[model samples]
Target: MEPLPSLEVIKLDEAPLAFTLATLFEPSSVLSQKLVPQLHEKLKSSPSPPTSYGELIGLAIDQVRTWNVDLQAKFISGHPRIGETKNLSMLSAKEQGANSDRPTVQPTPPKVLARLAHLNAYYERCYPKLVYIVFVNGRSRAEIVRVLEDHLGLAHSLSIDEPALETADPVDVGSQKWLDELERAVRDVGLIAKSRLIALNVA
Candidate 1:
C-alpha cells in the first residue's frame, strides 16, 4: 500500500481523459459552470455546434483504467473469496440450517460480480464513461479490478496488472494546485454547456 501518485499536477496529454480528469476533479470551474447554459442554448437552436464536452467526460473515465492496475490488485488481494483463499467456512455456517448436502449457498465471486455491476450502472447513469477515480483510496488494485471486471464483464479490455498498481503515488501539493485551476476551467466549461443546453431548449 504505497503512497499513490499525486494526480493534482500531472501533465495531462491532449486527450479526452485529460479533460475528463479536469472536469471531475474541478467541477466548479467557470467554464464548466457556463457550459450548462451553452448546451441548453445549442439544443434549443436547430443548428447546434458540435461540442466535445461529452467526449471529454468520456475520456476522463477512460484514464481511470490506468489506475485499475492498483485497484484490481487490491480488490483481488483483499477478497479471498474470489481468489484462492476463499472463506468457505462462512458459507458453510450460513447454510448450516439448510439441507447440508443440498444447501443453497451463493459464492463470494457472484456477490462481487453483482457489486461491480451496480457500480457500472451507477457510473453510466451519472455520466457517459465509467467513473472509478473517485474510489481510489489506499485500497489494493486487485480489489478494484475484480469489481470492475465483474461489472464490465470479460468483454471490457481494461487491464490492471500488479506493476501498474505498484507505481501509483498520491496527488502532491503542486498537483493539487494545478487541479484547482483545472477545476475552475471545468466549471467554466460546464456552465457554458449548461447555458447552451438551456438556450437550445428555449429556441
Candidate 2:
C-alpha cells in the first residue's frame, strides 16, 4: 500500500515505472507489453508528468481505450467476477461485497444464480480467453442477466455472417453495444479501485 513515487521519478526510472504498472495490472500482463511503453513515452514528452494519482488513472485508462482484443482481454481477466467465491482483489472484494462480514446479505435465488454463472462461462466460450466485464454497481442478479444477455445478443447478431471484430478498438468498433459496455466496465472497474488507492495514499 505504498504511494507511487512522483510521476517525474517514474518517468526517468524504468524500474519504478515497471513497478507502478505491476501494481496496477497483473504481473506479466499485456499492460506491461502494450500500455507501459506508451505511457512512458507520454511521460517523457509531455511538459508535465501526472501531478496526482487521478491524472495517472486517466492516462492509464486512455491507453486502455487504444488496446486491441488480446491486451484488453488480458486486462479484463484480472478482475474477479461479481459474487465469485475466490480470486477477488481488495477492490473487488469491497465493491462486490465478495468479502462482506455482514450476515444479513441475502443470497441470490437458486435458479437465477445458476443462470448468471452459466452466462459467465458461455461468454468465455464465445470470446476465448476474454472474461465478460460488466459494471455491477450494485445491480440485482436479474438485471445483470439482462445486461449480459443484451450484450451477448448484440455480439451474436453482428457475427451472424462473419466473425466478430476481434482487433477493432472497443470505442471505434462499429456500433457494437457489447463492446461499448465492455470497455466502460474496464474503465470503471479500474478507475474506482485506483482512485481509492490514491485517496488512501496506497500504490
Candidate 3:
C-alpha cells in the first residue's frame, strides 16, 4: 500500500452538479445493493412517490440544486465586497505606472461569504457521515497509515475506501490487491470482515 494523494473535500458550492449527477446516475458494474432498498424506504416515508425514473432522478437533482442556491444566497449576504479591490504592484509595468504603487485589497464580498457559510452549515447538517476514498499513487504503507490516522478518524468498524471496492472489477488483479490490502487493514484492527470478492463474487 502506498500513501495516496490527499483527498480533497469538495465544497458544496464548488461542485458541478450536472457532472456529478451524470456520473452518479450512470450504470456501473458495481452497484450498491442497499441503494434501491434505502431509496424505497425513503420513498415510503415521503408524502408522495415519484411516478418515473426521470422524476426520481429529477427530485435528487433538485435537492442538490436547492442546496447550491441556498449556499450562494448565504455567501452573498455574508461577503459584500468580494470583487472591488485593485492592486497596482502585481500589474504589468505599463499598468502599474498608471496607478499608485500599492497592492490591491479586494475583499471577499459579504454576500458570497454569507452564502458559503450557509452552504457549509447545510452540508454539515445533512451529511454527518464523511465519506473518504483513498487512491494509491505510489507511496509507502507507513505514510498512508499515518495520513488515515491523522486526518480521517478511522475506526474499527468504519469501512475504508468503500466506493473503490464497490467500483472495482472482480476479474482485475489490481482490484484483488486492493481488496487484500483493505481486508488486512480491517483485520489488523481486530474486526471479522469478508471481502466482496469472496462474498459477492463467489455467491
Candidate 4:
C-alpha cells in the first residue's frame, strides 16, 4: 500500500484506499488494523468502488456502527471534540473554520469557549467514554453551544427514565438514548468526512 498520502495528495477518485481512510479519520491504530482492511475487502467484492468519496465514507460509517460496542467507541472517539480551539488536524481545522488566515475573521469568544468546555466535560461525565462530536458545518460557537445544551438535556431525561443504565456495564450499556447518541455521532463523523472531502475539491 502507498504511504499515507499528505493532505495535498488526497483526490477522492485517484488516491489509494489508505489515503481516503487517513483523510476521513483521525490517526487511530484501529483504523489501520481494522477499518481500512475491511473497506479494502469491501471494495474488492463490490462491482466497483464508489465513484464518490462521500459514498465510500457512508459505507465506512455503516461498518463502524455494526462493530461491537468497544470497537465502535474506539472508532467514534477518534473524532475531534466540538468547540476545540487547538491541535486540530488540517482537515478538522478547515472543518471547524478555526485559526483562519484571513484577518477579517473573528475568533469565538473566550466566554463561549469556556461554556463549551464546561458542557463538554459534563457531557463526558454523563456518557462515559464518549466525546461530544458535532459536524459544526459553519455553525457559530453559540449555535454549537445550544446543540450541546440540548443534547445534555436529552441525555439527562433519558437517564432519569432509565436509571439502571448508571450501573450497567460501561461498554455494554443498553440504553436507547445512549445508543442513539452513539449512532448520531457516527453519522456526524460521516457528514464531517464527506464535507471535508468536498472541500478537498474531490473530482
Candidate 5:
C-alpha cells in the first residue's frame, strides 16, 4: 500500500511482500535477520492478513518470544542507550530528538539527565540482557525522566507501565508507532529471562 510511508516497511500485501522482507532487517542484526523471513512467511500464510501496521508489529512481538533466549538477548543489544545520539539509525535520531544527552524537543534538568545516565549504566549492570525501552511518546523532558526513574524500580519486573507513537519522505504514524511499541515490547519481554535469573539468584 503505497510503500508504507517511509518507515522502511513494505506493505503487507502479497505482491511486494517478498521484495520488502528482503530488506526489512539490518543485515548486521541477527535478530532482525532471523525474524524478517519468519515474519514474511507467517503473514504470507495467515488466513487473514494483518489488519493494520500495529497488528504486524504484534506478530513480530509474538515471533520474538519464540526465539531462543540467547537470540533474544542479542536482539536487545542492538538498541542504543538512552540519550545516545551518535551513530544512531536515522529512525532513532528522528524519534529520540538529539539523542538522550541533548534533547531539543524539550530540555530536561541536568540533574534529571544525570540520573537517567546513571540508570542507563546501573540497569545495564543489573540486567545486561535487556536495554531500557521507554516509548517517549511526546512527553516533556521531565515526564520522560520520570518514567526512566519508575522503570528503575521495576528493574526486576521488566514491566511496561503505560505512557507510550510516529510520519512519509516522513514516516507514517502507524509504522513508526509500531516500531516504537514493538521494540519496547521486545525489551520488556526479553527482561523476563533476567527476572527469572534474578529470582533464581543466578543473575
Candidate 6:
C-alpha cells in the first residue's frame, strides 16, 4: 500500500486531515465534521503536530470519547458490523480479507454469514445503538462467530430500551458487561487504526 504523505504535508490542509481520518476510521461525514476542526485546532496549537502516528491517533481517540455518549455510541456504530459482507470501507475490506489489492480470497460461505448475521442481531439487541466491532485482523468468519458467541455469553440479553443517555451518567449507560463490550470496541478501533498505520508505512 502507498504510504500516506508525511505529517508535515497532511497538516497543511483540512482536506488531508479529513482523508486521513476517514482512512484511519470509517468514512462518515458526521465524524469528519466533528473531528476535522478539532484536529486542525490541535495541529495549530502546537508548533509541531504530533511527531508520531501514535500521538495523532491518541488525539483522535481522546476527541471522540470527549463527546456525549450518544454521539460516541453513534460514531462507534458507524463501523461495519463484524462479518459484514457489503459496502466495506477499504481499510475494513482489507482487514477482513477481501480487498482488491490482495490476491482473491474465497467468499465466506452463506451458512457462516447467516450465523454471523444472527449473532450480530443478538449483540445489537443486547446493547442498543452499539454494533459489535472487532479488529478482525485476518481472522476467519468461523473464528469471529465464535468470539461473538463468547461475548454473548458474558452479556445480559435484555429488552432493549431507549435510555435517557444525554442526562444519564455516561458510565452507567449500560450494564457493566455491556460497558465492557463498548470499551472493547473502542479499543479495537484504535488497534485497527494502528495496524493500518503500520501497514501503510511498511517498506
Residue range with the least summed lDDT across 10 consecutive positions in model 6: 156-165
**After best superposition, candidate 3 residue 152: deviation in angstroms?**
30
Residues 1-203 of candidate 3: C-alpha lDDT, one tens digit per residue? 11211112111211232222222232211112222333444455667665433444445433323333333222122211112123211211111121223223333334433433333233222222212223222222333344443433333222333223233233222354433433332222111111111211221
Worst 10-residue lDDT window, candidate 4 = 156-165
Assess the local accuracy of residue 131 in candidate 5 as a C-alpha lDDT between 0 and 100. Answer: 59
How far is 7's C-alpha from truth in model 4 (Å)?
Answer: 16
Best by lDDT: 6
For model 5, the superposed segments whose C-alpha errors exceed 4 Å read: 1-28, 98-113, 154-203
Top candidate on TM-score is 6
How high a TM-score does candidate 1 get? Answer: 0.19
Q: Look at candidate 6 and tell me the lDDT of residue 117.
A: 73
Q: RMSD in angstroms, all models?
A: 18.8, 7.2, 22.8, 6.5, 14.8, 6.1
Instruction: In model 2, state the lDDT of residue 160.
Output: 22
lDDT for each residue of candidate 2 in 1-203, tens digit (9 for 90 to 100): 56666767888866788777666544455666767778888888888788766677788778877877556767777666644645544545444542234312336666656666666766665655567676555565556666776766643221222223353233333336557655776776576547455334564
List the global CA lDDT of all models: 0.32, 0.61, 0.29, 0.67, 0.48, 0.70
> Which of candidates 3 and 6 is the stronger one according to TM-score?
6
> How do all models score by TM-score?
0.19, 0.63, 0.18, 0.77, 0.56, 0.81
Candidates, ranked, TM-score: 6, 4, 2, 5, 1, 3
Q: How many angstroms is residue 105 displaced in model 3 relative to the true structure, after the best TM-score fit?
A: 53
What is candidate 1's lDDT per residue for 134-177, written digit by digit as tens? Answer: 22222233465454545433333233232233233333323543
lDDT of 6 by residue, 1-203 (tens): 44566678767787777777777887776677788788878887777678877778778888887777677777787678877768876667767764435633448777777777777776666677688888877777767877777766533222232222232222235677666767788788888888887657631
Return the lDDT, model 1, position 183.
40
User: How does model 4 fare in lDDT?
Assistant: 0.67
Could you tell me how far off, in angstroms, the CA of residue 14 lies in candidate 5 after the best superposition?
11
Model 5 weakest lDDT span, ten residues long: 162-171
Q: After superposition, how far is residue 170 of candidate 2 from its true place, in Å?
A: 17
For 29-112, candidate 4 gives per-residue lDDT tens digits of 777778878877777667755666667787888888779877877887887777686776777766665433331224777777
Which of 5 and 6 is the better model by lDDT? 6
* 71-101: candidate 5 lDDT, tens digit per residue: 7556656655666646754434444553433
